[model samples]
Target: MSLPTWELIRAAGLTSYFLLFVSVSSGLLFSIKAAKPKTNQLLQVAHQSAGWFSLLFGLFHGLLLYIDTYKPYSLVEIFIPFTTKDEPLLNGLGTISLFIMVLLFISGDLMKKVGAKVWKKIHRLALPMVILISTHGIMLGTDSSNGWAIVLYASSLAIILSLLIVKLLLIKAKTKKVISA
Candidate 1:
């Protein structure tokens, strides 16, 4: 069946969101790799560039959703969780994920001012937000059933999870060394 023009526009918006997701994930990976003080400046530059791109695309995606007018969605529907009739659960989670995304973006900038401990606590929310975003995409997204989308989502999540695991192990090793000293 041929998609209507509205559907086409919606699809484009969703595709932009997906691209933002990928770019943000890659940026995070690059940032993690660049955590070393020296010899990883290139990754840091890539991280910063990709981060800005992701933010731009993400804003565009959200703005397109608001402006499309194909569907009768209110600002409440876009921003508030579980406020809409269509796909309440998914939309609710997505709303929360959006808030978390905003928090992540802000915290990235505030980390310098807030110090590492506070920033780490705030950044921990990224994991839940990622999971919520993944769930929201799969449950409410039109392309969720597509094999490539599923693979891309799963792989991105896996990469982030792996990075978290490595970070945890490194922390543990450091703690053990401190105790042994």
Candidate 2:
């Protein structure tokens, strides 16, 4: 038997959201590690290119929700989130996540003018935003019930979290070595 129409839409949305998440995370990781001149240049190019693609696909993913008639969502619900009477909390969090994503997109281009120190402070928001966005996806998304989606989401989380832990450990080790020297 063919899958239900709603299932297809959910799958599409989940896939698009996954791509957006990966693109942003990869861009951020590349940016943070890009210190050397040649590597920095390459990373910057990759970040910008991937960022644009993520934004484009993310917009399309959001629009698809509106287009899917089986579980049609209004423009307001699409943008505002949590406006859906059926699920207020998840939708509200999703709205906040969307706002954070917008800030990330805008601030990325303005990092130079904003000053590296100040931008670094602002960029810390990315971690929280990603967590919130992922939570929103897990809670409100239709694909939340799917085993594959859960596995993908969890894997992404594990990778990011592991990278962060390693980065911190390395920093601390370097600091200790410097003090001893």
Candidate 3:
């Protein structure tokens, strides 16, 4: 059976959110000094790949809305944050997240030109991007109340939060070791 247009939009939005989770989690591993070199490389690849996928899927979801007979969105609203008259705040959060993703993607290559420290700071936006994306989904997604969607969102949030805690602990331990040494 053929799927409805809204169903396609829902699937793309959910997939994009899932990809965003993968991208952010993989990016966090790069911050751990103790992470194995080989493992870090793999994580970098995953982060890059997932970031691209998430952006693409997000774009697809927004583009699908252009043809949505129920509620059409203009390009300005879809691409620009805070411009959508309908659910402006929620859509703005998502638009901001997309811009963050684009920056991170470009900064990966620009690291050489911009210097590693600058690039790293830019990439750190991933955490905030996650917040923006999650809030956008929760506030705007129609399928967000579904049992599966709730579980997915909760699981992703728990995992990312745990990873953040781990990164913080790792940083603290390294700091203490340095001071004691």
Candidate 4:
């Protein structure tokens, strides 16, 4: 039995993006100390779970493209940046985002060995990963012009950007407090 590769690719990509949103939101909440201690623990778990699933779904999304009868992608084309004939730049961004996601996942897992500072530095790549994936979807996705997809892209970008700004403000405030002491 053969599955519908194109539909699966779209579904997986959308699902991955949604999970990434959840993960980022949860991570921001956790980092900002917005929840109570008990709830914070739950948020941490949610963040980790969502991140793992996001990566999984993202990999599924990319792999499905390899098997797509309409537009089959070679492993090299899919994994390497700017190697595809179709939409090279946008697809390259997606490919780079995928590598960043994988790096984030691995660095997170090896946080202890990598040290907190290094892990945090690598975690910062989440911002660019979101941007790349959003651009890839908005520009290259087949459903990008649809109302629901448009809403999803815009709203997700808004929410994530808002939270990021809040996180930055909180960091600045904390720094000021430390300096004033």
Give the TM-score of each candidate. Answer: 0.76, 0.76, 0.91, 0.96
RMSD of each: 3.7, 3.8, 2.0, 1.1
Between candidates 1 and 4, which one is better according to lDDT? 4
What's the TM for model 2? 0.76
Candidate 3: TM-score?
0.91
- How many residue pairs clash per model? 0, 1, 0, 0
Q: Which is superior by lDDT, 3 or 4? A: 4
Worst 10 residues of 4 by lDDT: 1-10
Q: What is residue 36's positional error in candidate 1, in angstroms?
A: 7.3
**Cα-based lDDT at residue 165, candidate 2:** 74
Estimate the overall C-alpha local distance difference test score of candidate 1: 0.67
Rank the models by TM-score, top first. Answer: 4, 3, 1, 2
Q: Give the least accurate 10-residue stretch of model 3, judged by summed lDDT.
A: 26-35
- The model with the greatest TM-score is 4
Question: Model 4, residue 61: displacement in angstroms?
Answer: 0.7
Question: Which wins on TM-score, candidate 2 or candidate 3?
Answer: 3
CA-lDDT, candidates in order: 0.67, 0.69, 0.86, 0.92
Q: Per-residue lDDT tens digits of candidate 2, residues 78-111? A: 7886786667776666666667667777777788
> lDDT per residue, candidate 3, 1-181, as tens digits?
4337787888998999999899888877766645789989999889889989998998898888877767778888888779988889998898888788789878887878989999989978888888888899987898889899899899999989998999899889989999999
lDDT of 1 at 153: 74
Q: What is the lDDT of residue 9 in candidate 2?
A: 53
Off by over 4 Å in 4: none
